[model samples]
Target: MREVQPVATAHLRRDETGHRRRVRRLPLVAVGALVAATAVALPQFTPDAKAATTLRGYADGRGVKIGAAVGDGPLTSDSGHTAVLDREFNSVTAENAMKWDALEPTRGSFNWAAADRLVAHASAHNQGVRGHTLAWYAQLPSWLKNGNFSASELNTILKGHIGTKVGRYKGKVYAWDVVNEAFSGDGSMRGSLWPTKLGTGYIANALRWAHAADPAANLKRFSDLGLEVSVTELDVRIPLPASSAQQSADYKPASLNPNE
Candidate 1:
């Protein structure tokens, strides 16, 4: 039997305005399902005649890549988790170390210790790095959220944050989730502080700034529950509920024509 510990429901249940939120649970359920599916779908074969090999080895043999999310604590520590990560994955994503709150708790002050550790580990292991995010509405520092800055000030802040983070990891990170979870279930832009203040074009501006920072890195929009799609030349819409059925039904394959 699996031992389940009690989780703090307060933070997960309430939104920024102290309102009861049900949407948060959907992503958790979707993630659980995705994990189970991935475990069952993983190939159980050796790529070569080597004595011991891993999923990364098999993927490398077939010109495919496999990656996993790794927290800074485990990646920086001497433990089995780090050992397995180094051996089994060809890429690593920082679970939280690269987020807005984690990376910049105060204005103009950056914390790269945790993020740098993960990048170094990936580099030493001969793996690529996927910058988890450059723009996210959630988990932002209170200072930024409550700064009451003007539109021009906020634009400068946003661009500065993206340029600093992405520029630091240029060429090191092969891909970046330039913007995350910017849309709702019905394919409309979500009303976060960013859109509330910066307008919907914030997504485009973010991608542009990230590209400017790292022209070599692949800029991507990461949706919840494995609904990632490339936003290199088009605006992609991801549906909510994050289930395979809902995703298939609402996820349009064609990108929206910007001119239209």
Candidate 2:
């Protein structure tokens, strides 16, 4: 097995003195590739071949919650992966196991095997589990995507799916990415089966359905509708072989938001 190199992680927030300070720093382990988002990078603290503070330890000391996008394969198969996960992070988000297609691939026949394993692992480790998503435009089951259901029928199906899936993990999950990437890059609603059939109200409906299933779980990121907002998937991607000047400049925008 290859060793993962540790890099510093910073959570920028204003202190009581109203000055921004480096409250936490962890060793970053680049996990794997991602598509539109950035790669999964798990944090650790292994320096100079000796014992040191872990990512979770450092974050906890500073009153911050550090997390990583974990894959079910690694959680079950790789000891090193789990060791890093259990020690370095206090929260886990399923990379794909909790997606729509993975949960209900054949309309009514739901499969909770992989997702259950993830939740169970988190529970065993006393770590919080962040429900990946309740609604998204991608990774939809073929039955739901290709079926010829009317608007009313699709809305019912959406509500049922959210209720069943969210209800199953009600108290176990702490938060959910209720609706993922609903808008396009150009600031317009993306074309999807839900919007095409049930209209844009599907986003609001999905949020309500998820909340009904688990009112305690935070279904944030809808500040426009008077809901709280959260910043997830923080990354600064630069072109390959970029100069240090270019990379530093790219991160300026992210620094503007203390929450980022």
Candidate 3:
């Protein structure tokens, strides 16, 4: 197992009496990798040691554990392969696999039959779980497609969605995808009606509300809307980014027209 250690240091530009002061230094981790890049020389290793390391890495030991991910819904369950996956992995990740829309298709209606089973199974096996996707622009319910609501109404709706979901799985959730795809790859914040109406603080509010409901929640938000964007001119000149990027959708079944 590779141990992760952090190093912290600071440098003083000038003395306090003069003008400049010392600034804090960020911690750094030093770890060597065998195959960091596609082309790189590997360390000299005897055949015996190489095979041993490979076997040991896959064994349960004192190291960072891996987890399997499967949506807990009517269409999925912890069976044959999932049981093995749950046993092998120590954590799980979800994008829109586990979100408000998928769980609660209708407003104020809760569905826990599927997720609860997985949560219970994880707890029984001592495995960690990741609750994905609380807020985002896509994968929303049909009602939100073109429905126009006031600022206050929007805020209420967004908050309600986050609070109930995060609150329900507070204790068991390892971390959360608070808001996904809310920004461009350039690092600038993404645009959404919630931000325009409720303001930039909506992010802070989401985190706060999530924390209040689930104080122990570990929040992870993403906003890279353009990271893998694709523009289409087939329908009303729908504008987007390059269609060959890492996240392009030119060949997606959910493209312009599903039936097409």
Candidate 4:
């Protein structure tokens, strides 16, 4: 069985004015129902040039110790011997997730070529690629700043943005950040282009739409600069990593183990 992931409830269930607050949060979506869960790789732990030699030595005789998230760029089609490097360490990540100004400077338009190239390269060599994010308070288009629109119009905008992005990669993207950051430490939802107009439902709506766009995509929510976002929508308790230390025991840390 796949392991349950930790939730962000502690951050959401905080005290207010010296009293307990009844802040409710959404749970994780039924990931297994929609798709087989994707396993997240631990971040790179070593950066030494000789780290490879150390690892090689381990593989050669010492032991078979290898990191899960190890990666490098442009090795698939490198003119130099970098292609060989990619073949050796095939896992890589997308970097331009923070550069929204270059991605979608205009409303309803996207420049996915740069990212697509990376995903294509990784897929060609039988590797995995992660979509860094779907939404962030920072790195957003100025057009989205306090934009005026009806709720229906706002939902359409959000749907278009997420659907296009999530659909473009489809199965190529092993995982996706369906909704990046949508809450504050005080258990309040983050006000953004969607929430400001579409309110709380925007979160679930985004997840639902993205799930349909790519059923095989693994859904992940992040906030507070890389912290997992766990919300309890309706009754689904997505166990996200805690955003802070103020949570109750019900929201405990859980492992997201690989599928059996």
Evaluated with lDDT, which candidate comes out highest?
2
Q: How would you encode candidate 2's per-residue C-alpha lDDT over 90-146 as one tens digit per residue? A: 777777678888788898898898899988898887666766676677778889888
Candidate 1 worst ten-residue window by lDDT = 30-39
Model 1 steric clash total: 0
Task: Quote the lDDT for 160 in model 2.
Answer: 96
Query: What is the per-residue lDDT of model 3 for residues 21-48, given as tens digits with 9 covering 90 to 100?
Result: 2121110111000101112121222224
Instruction: Compute the lDDT of residue 144 as modeled in candidate 4.
Output: 66
Which residue pairs in candidate 2 have backbone atoms (N, alpha carbon, C) closer than 3 angstroms, thus clashing? 7-28
Off by over 4 Å in 1: 1-48, 51-53, 217-260
> TM per model?
0.66, 0.68, 0.57, 0.53
RMSD of each: 14.6, 13.9, 18.3, 14.3
Per-residue lDDT, model 1, residue 184, is 61
For model 1, residues 1-260, the per-residue Cα lDDT tens digits are: 22321111111111222311221112121111001111112223345656136766766676454667666655655488777776676666777778888889898899999899988887777776667676676878889999999888999999999899878876677666666667664557778888899997787788788777766543332243333222211235765548876565556555855333
- Superposition error at 201 for model 1 (Å): 0.9
Lowest summed lDDT across 10 adjacent residues in model 2 is found at 27-36
Q: TM-score for model 1? A: 0.66
The true-versus-predicted C-alpha distance at residue 259 of model 3, in Å, is: 46
- Per-residue alpha-carbon lDDT of candidate 4 for residues 62-156, written as tens digits (9 for 90 to 100): 22222122112333333453443343443344444323544677886787766767766666655455454564455566776656768887778
